[model samples]
Structures are given as structure tokens and as C-alpha cells.
Target: MAKKVRFYAGVEIDKDGIRHTWSADAWQQFMDSCKKESQAFEIRGRKIAGQCESCYSPAVFYMHLTKSRELSDWPEAGDASGSVSNLATRRDQTGIISILEYTYLLPVSGTPYIALLRSSSGPMPSAIADWVSLKSDMPAAGKSFELQPVLRNDARQKLNESLGVKSLEVRFEGKPDPNSTSSIERAAAEAASTIDESDYANVKVDMSISMGRATVVSNSTEAMRKQALSILTNNNIAKHPIKDMLSKGWVTKLKAKTLQANPESDKPIIEPVDFIKEHLTEDADFGSMKDDEMTPEIILSGMLEAIGKFRKRSNEY
Candidate 1:
């Protein structure tokens, strides 16, 4: 899988009622400085929020870095063995410091639809101890952020300068699927062709199963499309896993039904026997068996054996 590069910053307000924003550059500089000073910073009371802006359809994100940490390690330099002493001999220490942030995502001028993030945060003073003792007074936000970070191919050239990351060429992992348009715009244009209702229904059910939730009832086709896209993209479901799940689930359901059927009857149900016979016929060794050789007793034994093998394979997967 290709790795994605993301830019982030901290925003905060000080006790003196002054607000500050830290750009991605500033954050990177601070991190470098920390490394030079042989110290580490820890995030405290981290909170994040996201909302969709109406006009440009831009995504707005907010984050609060309530506190910071100053960390120090003992024996500043490693011993001759290139290993530091154990915890008993080591003197590691850290302290919590004050910091806060207010982040904004706004549309960039000229690029009417594109969103640009401006992050602000308070500065950390060097006077603070590298390993001062302090208690955490920040409250937990108790919320999670679920937004997927999107890096548009078009914006790569503009962002590469300051971000210092190379632009990634959007290349397919394998030969493009000939059945579907390889480009999003072309796919959208092609989708105008009439589609079967049964196909739509199957897609809805598959999306619901992939998300592990019931599909939201919606009258709008656009809404349904968005829901399905969100589930598929965020979950990153591959084709093989989905196909495997469907096949296994189908077999499991059929096995359950077969076991439940004819509980009151002395003889076994025909469904399981038929299922076993179908599988056995697929085997090269068993394919040579004549119809007359498959007696009722043989069928029952084959069904039991098939069921055992099916369960073992299922467990492995």
C-alpha cells in the first residue's frame, strides 16, 4: 500500500487571553527543536471536530491540544555497549505544560472549491522545566474523529513546496478494469445508462453487510450512493474478502437450515445429502464413482465427512 503524507498543526489560547495559531511549518520546526534538545512532547486533552461547509462543500476541521509534555531521559548518552541502564538505574522524567489550539479549514482563493487549513496554537516557553511535576487538569472531550483525509492529485504541485513531500502519481496498482471507466468523470457519465433495480438492491444489501449495520432508508439516489461510497472507502473492503464472506455465509446458512429440517423424521434430510454429493462429484477421485455405487448409507457417511471438513476449513479462514 502507498503511504500518505498529512500536514497538521496545533491551536490554543493562553491564560493572558491571547490566541495563537501554529502553521504546519511551525509544528515541524518545534518537533525538530525538541529532537535537538533531547526532549519529547506529549499531547494532552486532544480533541477534534469536523463539519461540512455548505457553499464550497469544504470540510472544516477543529482540534484542541489542551496541554503539552516535556520529557527527559537519564544518562543523556548511551554506554559503551550502545545500551542504556535498566529502569532501576535510569532516571527518566516528564512534566505536563499548558498549550491549546483552535483550527480552521477554509476555501483557498482562486481555487473556489478547494479547502485550505489554517491551524493556530499557543507557544511553549523554554523557561518551563524539562521534567517538572504537574497534574493533568484538562477534561476529556470523549469524542472521535472519523473523517478520511483526502489528498487531491491536482493540489500536489501547489502543496509540495512548503510541505516538502514529492507529488504522487495516481497510478493504478494493476491493469485497469476494462468493464468500468478508469476515471471518475467518465464513470459518472457512463452511470447515466439505465441500471437494473435488482442490481441496486444487491448493492444496498452488500454495502449494509460490509458496514456491519442496516442500510439507512433513503428516497434519494444520491444519498444512497454517498452512503455506499462512505462505507466502502472508509472500511477499505477488498473484492476477495467480500466474495469469501458471501460464499462462507451462504454455506453456513444452508448447513444450519439442513440440520434444523426433519428433526422429527427418523431419516436424514435430503438437502445435506445432495450438498455432499455435489461437493464429492467435484473431486477427481470421487468423480469416477458410478451412480449405482452411491447408496443411502454411503450418502449419509459422505455428508457427515463433508460437514466436518467444511467446519475445519471455515475455522482456518
Candidate 2:
């Protein structure tokens, strides 16, 4: 089995913000930055980072926004990780208008696939749709939700000025899907960088495409073929690019998974700190309950308990 490799890249966005542009050199820069940051100290999901796997240039920087954009309202965030969550609650309706976006970059086949996801708080309901709306009745926003980070690809320039190379061949790892790269390239053309419902519904992604070939190297060709097909088909990029790749005997079959499913119970879930308190007590899975159904007293009590935990952590508040 080939070694499992993942890259976390962060690019500094201008005041205008980073657009969805995932390109060859752009992704390379991101991985380089991440490696540099992790050289001495380690953080979330840290592991043994291999030798400088940076084949591209040291131009791009990958940024994981641990904060929110609405909270980035001011012009200069300037090294502040951003208290987006708190600012969001105070915002007009980050509760409704705001969303939680989680992005992942999977490095395979020497290529990168940026997974972008957008999740929102439950929306308001219509008269007759109350019961039905209780569940996830909202439209199923396709694979890429709106307002994904926009990346402006400067692959050629990055390669020449930064990476210092000629045309370096690139591929989306694990799958020889051309559209994976195409998707990233396509995302770069969102035109406007502003956030509006109309455009936000569709993310602008370019560099986040799958860049690589379907590769599974093993002692057994059978195992290699199966593993490659599993990953390629799972990501669904195979159908678009390398249609002829499947024509090969190595690829036996392709199958798409069924649609998956979420909820909006928002029943005052307990935080990790709370769990530690009550001396690691057990209570109702209130988060599974109704948000509107929660009482003021319950809310107050929970806050009090959380404060107590904070006090304990600080040795007094």
C-alpha cells in the first residue's frame, strides 16, 4: 500500500480575501507553509511529517481559517485568528445567514483535493411546512455549497518566479480525474468576491480540484487496481476525466454511494468543559432536543455551570 499523505496549506488572503483558486503552484506553496509551521512544534492532528515533499515551489501558503468571515468584518484582521464565532452570534443573523464551513485538503497521487463544505443553522418555516420543516427539508445544495473560499491561481507565475522551474507535470492524486483540476480552475471564475445568497449558494473553487493519477502500487496488481478504483469512484471524479482509464483491465467496476443525511435540534448541547464538570456527569442529550423548547432557567443554569468550570480551570474567576 502506498503511504497515506495529507497536506495542510494556508495562503494569506489580501484584504479582498482569498478566492477559490486551487492550482499546481498554489497548492505547493500551501503545503510548504504548513510544513514550516510544524517544523518545531506540533498542533492539531499533528504527525510525523516526512521530508520536504514540496515538489512545487515555496510560493503558496495554505491557511486554515479557524475563525469565521462575518467576524472578519473589519478591514485588518492582522494576525488575529479571529473570534468569528462570538462575532457571528452578534451579527445580524450569523445564526441564519451565517454558516459553518469546514474544508479539507487530501493529498493523493501527488495532487490535492480540497473538500469544501458549508452547513447552516435551520432555516425559518412556512405555515404548512412546520412539521415537514422540522426535518432537513431544505434544498439539497449539491456537492459544493455556496461561498467556498476563492483561490486565484497563479500557477505559471508561481512556478517560474517561485518554484523556479519549467512546466512541471502535475496530477490529482489517487484519481486521474481531469475535472478535479478543472473544478478548481472553474471555481476561480466566480467574478465577484462578495458574499451574497445568490452567489454564495455556489462556491468558487479552482485550486481545490483533485490533482493526480489513480495510483495504487502493491505487490499484487489485483489489490492495486481495487484500491485505486475504490478511491477514484468514491470521489466521483473518475467519471469526468480519464474515461479511458476505466477502459483498462485494471479497473473492474465503479459504484456510487447512496445519499447521506443532519438535523437542527440545537438543544443546548454540552461543551467539553461541561463534560469535565459535574465531575464528568451524565445528563440529557439536550442538544438532541428542540431549541425553541429550551427554558430560560435551563439556559441560565447551563451558563452558570460552565462558568463554574471556567473558574475551576483558572483556580478562581
Candidate 3:
């Protein structure tokens, strides 16, 4: 499967300490400087080992994450002749690991877009920000920069969707600690004391209820279930209990049902890389330009165009 790229927005503070979004012009200047001075930069106290390849254009750069470190020893493993042996530790031995990763940067009039190839061994967003900062124009007093992911709307949309709940079932089971200062805990303690002070320490609350639009069904004690739906929905029948449970963390087991005619849309969460690729094509009409293999210049051009389209979508929304 092809790897996906995660997107981000670049924000920078100027000498006056005013925050501003980076622009394409800003990115262009940064990349040009990087091309001119593509020396190994330090991150996490480690510098690029050797032959640091700095591939850059107006909007992108390939970060060669090569590092050298002392190799103390190797674990017991079979050699080429198929004989297992415990390798001895060698403090003087050193090893080098090389990794090639790409990050695309394209800033609009506002914040710039940064797209990075997502990989298990790739640098994190914060590390990427630091890497870019190193290549950035010499910092003025108070000047700094940051890179943040362009989050998907799924989380917000899911909150509003509310599973289109038609019914809700909740089960709460646990003993509240007597020492807890929470009002709920105190209420539980009081109820346990009323049941039997001798057994208060062993008391537990096991309550279950199922609520529909206009009716609630439960065999549990009336007081325990009383006003539960009200407490959850704040007297709003149209609201779902899930929201309350999420906010309060009071509900233990939850079973929610939606109308069969209008079933809830529980779309699978798209991976960051896949999400970006699909949007690039759907929203940006990014076609053949998304080639499997291309020259550095071509890749930069394609990414630059795609980012512009993304900026438009970002503005429209």
C-alpha cells in the first residue's frame, strides 16, 4: 500500500511577539535558504550521521534522518552458518542508521500547510517544527514557529451526530469510596449507611435503566433511577445520554439504539495519510500529478498545487 502524508499548518511569532501564519513566500524563502545551506542539523542531541541529502524545492524538502551512535552489543542470534552465539559487548563499535523522509510545506496568506510522510520511524510533528526552525531565517528576538496537524472534522461531526439515538440503556455498578469528596460519592455513602452501617463498607450500587423518547423502564429502585434521564439530559428529552456520560464519566455500560429507518452513520475513522490523499484528489482534483515516482521538482510542484487547493477548502469551511 502507498504511504499517506499527514498535513499541518505553520504558525510563527515575529520579533514583536505577534503571531502570524506563514505564507508561500515565507516557505519559498526558507526552502531556498535550505537548498543553499543544507548542512546537517541537530535534533535530540544527535546530528545527521553522513551524506545528508537535502532535496528541496519551493514547497518541500526531504529530511534524511541519518544518525550514528555507539552499539554496545548484539543479542544472541544465529550467524549466516546457522549457529546461535551470544555476541560480546563492544563499547568502541559504532553503527549508523539512515532514513529518508519527505515533508511538504506550502503556506497560504495565512498559515502554511505542512505535509509529512507518516512512518513508524519518522520524526514527530514537534520534531519537524524544530527541524524547520533550524532552517528558518535567523531568529529575531521573540521569533519562534510551530507546526500543528490539520485535524479532521470527524470528531466535531460525531459529537453533533449523537448516534441519532432513539433509545439509551445505562448500567452503573461500583462502590463509591467513603473518603471521596464528590457529591455523588457522598450520596452513595449516605444511601449505604441507611441500608446498614455494619455493611456500608461492603455496599455497592448496581443500577440499570433503559430510556425511550417518553418512557423509562427499569426494575431497579425508583429513587435510584428517578430523575436519572433528567439529570442526564438536563430535562431535554431530545438530547442523548451519551453526551452527559462523556462529560461526567458516570455511566459504566451503555447500549444505544437508533431508529431502523434512519440508522446511525458510524463511519470508520480514516487514517491521517489516507484521509489526506483522498481529500487531495476529491477536493483538489489532484489527478495524475500524484505520481508513484517523480523528480524532486515535480513532487514539489504537485504538492504545491495540492496545498493551494487545500488552502481554498480551509477558507471555504
Q: Could you give candidate 2's per-residue lDDT for residues 1-317 as a string of tens digits?
A: 01111111222223343323345554455456455432211112211121122222222223222212233432221225554444434546433444333222322113223322111211101111111111212223211111111111332122112211111111231222222222322223332233342333332222211112322222432332223222322232212232222211111122211111113542211111110111111122212344443332333233333333333432210
- Index of the highest-lDDT prediction: 3
The best candidate in terms of TM-score: 3
Q: Which stretches of candidate 3 lie over 4 Å from their true place?
A: 48-111, 137-140, 152-317
Question: What's the candidate order when arranged by decreasing TM-score?
Answer: 3, 1, 2
When 1 and 3 are scored with TM-score, the better candidate is: 3
Model 1, span 236-282: residue lDDT tens: 12122223121111110101011112468643332111111121111
TM-score of every candidate: 0.18, 0.18, 0.39
Q: Lowest summed-lDDT stretch of 10 residues in model 1?
A: 247-256
Sort the predicted structures by lDDT, highest score first: 3, 2, 1
Query: Which consecutive 10 residues in model 3 have the weakest lDDT in total?
Result: 232-241
Better of 2 and 3 by lDDT: 3
C-alpha lDDT values of all predictions: 0.24, 0.24, 0.40
Q: What is the lDDT of residue 234 in candidate 2?
A: 20
